[model samples]
Target: MGILSINMDDPMDVDALDAFLKIAEYRSLSAVAKLYGVPKSTLSLRLKQLEGELNTSLFLREGRSLVLTEAGQTLRTHAADILGRCEAARMAVAETLDDASGMLRIGATGEFGTAFYSQMLFAFRRRYPKVQLDLSFFSPHTLYLPERQEMMDAIISWDDGNAGQGGAEQLWTDRFCLYASRDYLARMGTPATPAELEEHQAVMFRQPAGPQLWLLQRDAETLSILPRSDLFANEYWTVKYFAVASEGIAYLPSFFTQIECERGDLVRVLPGWESAQQRVTLRVMRPSALSRRMGAFIDFCRDYFSPGYVFNGPRYYVETIFNPTNTTQTGEQR
Candidate 1:
């Protein structure tokens, strides 16, 4: 193949360039002409003008079939790129004239999305009534699965290690904490130290792959908890329920246990301990260029989850859990 130079004295026509690219794509001038609502003769004439400007034979005809020459193939590459930029600019301008309207699909674990993020979703919809919001809550382990990954426009969940390979941005940081209902604590006699956790019956969250290990730290000190237990559940709410039923000690996200803790329904096992902080990031693995609606949604999420965003849950207190008078004198489990 030989290099062909365009004459700077004469620039190519944008419409002609678009037609040339379309002809290259369809491989038939008549087909492209009909698609564009133009005559076949006009398509050929424009392409000839483009070829004339470049001073090369654009195509060779064999009977009714047209084949592109080496130079024509080169021009086709440049023409497609030039045409794409024009289309993109047109779309960008058109967005400013119209409201952002489209469907946005987000993915996250049922535990986090339903408990915390649902509020954010409702707020987002209030701002963009024209844009439909679809929040899909899936199992935690399935987040990185190829099919599920393809469905989310944006995802809000714990930083999945695999997601870093794609477009993952850390939105917030949170830590898990050991929590057990007052009833359970009363029955187990409260594990004052991390070492005492070994003797206490523990309720644990089992992921799809296996049980998650419990690691806690405080400054230079650290502890690895291997609690003895029989109770297990996948859902965080279920784990909380089991703990409330005096089943065992459960470790849950701090945000989820905040209400329970404040009301004294659940007590922190080790006040000195802090679980390793897990980062939560907004991940976008689906489309290459986000639509206007999706971009607006992402921006809304960043601010909504910001630390400065004031949020407080309604104060709730249970008489049986918080007041000794409401319970039996023994305060002992059945």
Candidate 2:
């Protein structure tokens, strides 16, 4: 409970610090030792030395594994951080080094945001475990320009109003589809085309009635439809839930309904109707002014989502030009 004398005079204890952190993470001395290709005895001795220096017992044995004591858990936190700094310093020695650790603030829409973010975020975390991620989700709105927020390092959005404002990158393109519960289709009958959509009971988005026409392509000709709905809700999740419950037909992104469609829970009506592209883009709001850590994250995304990096249905598109006017970025990074 008393303040302990902290010693900074000691030369950087990188090895011991790394060992302790690893041990704490694995909760096993043998595991840490094996990981570092060192004997368990040496690992145990190094940990003990660290404890002695700090004048505290860092861990307690419980069965075959080690559990951090109250003091130990606190030490583990610091040790991991210290090790991270050491790695960064080592990288700094080389001109090619990039800082890969820091807090990255991101914003996105609810449905599509939740669907892709969970996986994209998970993968990013695994690759850059040291980076702290903060995400905010909202319905599509021209609220805060990603650059103005300053806090938001990047934005993955369908709206490209701020596309070229800062260094921007496009992640993926999203397609909206008319979806309904299987049971509802069996009873209400499936509409063969957009014109037929009027007859089905529908769930609409936000304070609006009737089905919203999703423009598929607008170059040579404009493809649009007016969806009729009895129930209206602001959130995409709400529409999805209602659709799943056999309430009515809801227009939603294919990605969000992909799982359900595959499982036969939801069916895509009016196949071959190309939904106008909803530009799914990522804009680096503060690219040039990015901190070293933020830069690393941007680089990670560029590579992680690159076509060659991983193969999947969702393609990545990179728009060279950043358009601050339009709602979506034209570049595809997929």
Candidate 3:
């Protein structure tokens, strides 16, 4: 007895193996045809061709049902492995091609999507013109849910130090600090300490459950304050602009206010204190077997937010932004 052989060069024979697997799994030729939208005759013909090539009776029909013969059971095991390896080889070739082409689905929070990842993704599209991006924004709470995570190839989200067992790659840590317009500071008087924040009005970030306490830290001391606020907004940019218009002091992330601080549109209020810190992370579903497009995107983002990158560091009002002699053209300290 010799080993069985099927002509892999014949496309129909290859497809026949696939049809055989489907039929074996479903145990119904008509059912597989209906599910795959292929004609029953086409599947039957392919199955017969596959059986002929191997000189084996793959299936035995008993009334309305088809049961796998001993040969079919044996072929089933090898067919899946053969088809799987073929797919792997095809993907390996595709990954090596210079141009990566595919639809890459990504998820991020609305704030981060608008303020950060959107710009990064725009640049990615420019670099890989063939890759189509489908970016969707979700709330931080629901962004990483298993059902939601399944829909995206990758997700950029805040790592609240609770992403247990979930593969999350830390991109960068963003710090939030108090900010106010020069005019607001002049009119309301700049706060010298967290104690003075009680006297100043605040542009609060409205949460679903109403305003939350602003947690500020300096050295070993930590203080939580609910600043006096008549103004409230859910969006970061809106809060920044509201503060810019001399409405009130705003607690904002350093990354989002870099440009405004550089232009003297917004001033960091307490250089010694930081309100909050959030670790940004990239969660790729399958890191080991990433597509070329996704791999390029992950690399680009890692480099974009890497240490010593111009836009990756903290921007201070008194030191980096206001000090004309110390700041560079990229809005970072020299």
Q: Name the candidate that leads on TM-score.
A: 3
Q: TM-score for candidate 3, please give it.
A: 0.64
TM-score of each: 0.63, 0.58, 0.64
**Candidate 3 per-residue lDDT over residues 10-35, each given as its tens digit:** 54356888899888867898888877
lDDT of 2 by residue, 2-68 (tens): 2223467754367888788778767998776665578999888888777767777878889998888
Q: Give per-residue CA lDDT, model 1, range 140-215, as digits (tens).
A: 5777687566546777777566546676887778888888877667766888888888889988887777666788
**For residue 62, what is the lDDT in candidate 3?**
83
User: For each predicted model, how many residue pairs clash, with residues at least 3 apart or on different chains?
Assistant: 0, 22, 0
Could you tell me which 10 consecutive residues in candidate 2 have the lowest summed lDDT? 325-334
The lDDT of model 1 is: 0.73
Q: Please give me the total number of clashing residue pairs in predicted model 1.
A: 0
